[model samples]
Target: MAAASLNVENVTGLLQDCLSKLGFEVYPLKVGWYNSVLSPSLRLPFPDDSLAVVVLSTPAMFEQAFLPFMEQRGCQGLSDPIDQCVKHCATSAVSQCFPGQNVDVRYDYELLPSRKPKFLAQTAAHVSGAAFYYQQSDVTDQPWAEKKMFGVCVHPRFGGWFAIRALLVFEDVVVGSEVVQPVPPDCVPTREGRIQLLESFNFHWQDWSYRNIICPVQTYSQKQRDYFSARPAERFALLRTWGFLPKEDHQPDISSDAQSEMITHG
Candidate 1:
């Protein structure tokens, strides 16, 4: 049994479907902001010292930023231009993953310049993509700090909303007699199947320290399509404050059965 933690959005159902079909019990992480910060030593997210096979995915931004760039550059892709930008945004996150070690600078193309393009391409693709997936970095400063505080300000002309991909798979799992039920087989109920599992997980910025943030999976399932259809008011509000152009379609979709109600923001 393997487990990997990542910040993705709405993947529990997909995980439940795949793991259950394979006959592996898949219990997801239960989150409570205060739980970790209030008691760092408490094994609140998962079982203590649990060792399992881990499979982690990365954010789409990481994917978009790194993948195509690697393909264009030679085998030693990291030495290429994109790594410079990735490192700029990824400094804090990379440090969290590799604390004592220096940044792994050996781009394959650079190291094996004599290698053929096809062979080098495969190697660089694997390494660069793998680094994005597993290399944990803390975005506690600089650009991340700004984005987190002001939300993701992509473009002045077309600022977008920030959607969070929550991270699961923690160090703790079982809590007393409460064995969190594994994701059921029939429960793989989303459009993206097991692959969608990764897509469902992402980190949304919540300023509410007043209450512990929790992933509302049931709501996600009930309103899956609606959630992704268009931007929410809150998102637009943030963008407006950031001085971005207003959304073209300000009207909410009245047709959606989910008919998204206004959420109370603290």
Candidate 2:
């Protein structure tokens, strides 16, 4: 299993197997190769032609392995439950799949202090040779925002129920262009049209309100819709009861004024 000999299919299969074992459905969002000699503007930790970046995402699927651990720690050790789970699962997967290989795994929030806010977009573009865009950030010119829903990134299939999990950097790996392509422009709706649609639906943006109306993609699953439709408080309570959060402070927005603000705004 030499690094250069490993193709896209091989790596993809390996990742799928490893992550599925941890109760996650792996989605290969983007794949790109880094050539330092060709693109000097792209700064990477590895040398030219030695690194390949794979942007992987996952839905909100809770792993049973985390239950016992969460029961004891109560999500106190990590800032985000999803991040913790993704990082742990990815690290384990890489170790098992590529024994003795050099791989660097990084999450969305694990950027260095010196890194810029749009580091994810920059890195993805540099590696894949395609433009990338994300909502709530001034990173790239690509318009991928669902303006009706507070400007969150929306995928054609998963909609808002999925999250960008991590960037898996493989040293000395080669990925083909066939497996890597720019995200479809049609996936993002126009800002003006989305705003008009929101207005028509009588949706209002509220500060810290439990319910906010946003149009989902046509391909969004019914299960995903149901999950996002629940009130924030109810969702938080359920997570706490499932040992995903501390029992005493089940709510994420801890400020005492939060309830009052929600009431006033709602």
Candidate 3:
């Protein structure tokens, strides 16, 4: 699988299949080419004119396949369990498909603490080619930066339930399209009140709620709401029993500085 010989359609299909095998619902949000030099804020590992693909994916928990797969794997635990699982599955799939190709596999969460790259910022830059802004208002006027919320981007269908799973950077491929289009208005905020929207929009599990601006029950299925509504202990147990948790010892301890850094830029 040489990078130059990589077919976009083929590779995209392979990725979708791989994600499906790992119990993820693949939703390819954007496909484009990026020149890293055009965006100084994004610290991407790849060079200019790299082909980039951003996916908005969620753990297909409601699907019949996920629970069985988890049961088969046996369970362990991690801090960001789902993200870690997706990272592992994505890395394996990419490696198997493009053994020695010049590709970079990035995740929403930093798997390797020693190499903490800002994947979210890089994804935003690749898709939008502008300095990534967390505030929707700042980039709301910018067409390229559509679908972006505060720090994280939201999917019209998945709302906050999904994760920005992977960003595949193919050095050899260059897509012709450079124009960025606005995402569907499904998740866009209304003029009722911006502050109120942010206050209720909870991405963390600490105080999870589906009533936020981004979360419309129609977009996120009733099944997803039930999954989130589960007690934390029960959820953790289920994830652990199904081998979704990261190894206890493998979890990284974030220093105060690192924590602040993630908060500042995430």
* Top-lDDT candidate index: 3
How well is each residue in 50-100 modelled by candidate 2, as lDDT tens digits? Answer: 444444443334434344445544555424444555666678788888988
Model 3 stretches with alpha carbons more than 4 Å out: 21-41, 59-69, 75-80, 111-116, 121-152, 177-186, 202-207, 210-266
Query: Could you give the candidate ranking by TM-score, starting with the highest?
Result: 3, 2, 1
Tell me the TM-score of each prediction against the true structure. 0.18, 0.57, 0.61
Off by over 4 Å in 1: 1-59, 62-81, 89-91, 102-266
Q: Estimate the overall C-alpha local distance difference test score of candidate 3.
A: 0.48
For candidate 2, the TM-score is 0.57
Q: Write the per-residue lDDT of candidate 3 for residues 1-266, one digit (tens) a residue.
A: 66667655667777777666544543332333333323544456564445555544453533534455455553344343444445557677778877887766666655455465546533453244221223445333443333545443444444455445566676666544543443333344543434344434424423444334455343335554444454433455445444655445343443333332332221
Instruction: Tell how far residue 65 is off in model 2, in angstroms.
Output: 7.5
Task: Give the CA lDDT, 0 to 100, for residue 194 in model 3.
Answer: 40
Q: Output the TM-score of candidate 3.
A: 0.61
Instruction: Name the candidate that leads on TM-score.
Output: 3
Q: What is the Cα-based lDDT of residue 171 in candidate 3?
A: 62
Better of 2 and 3 by lDDT: 3
Clashing pairs in 2: none
Clashes of each: 28, 0, 6
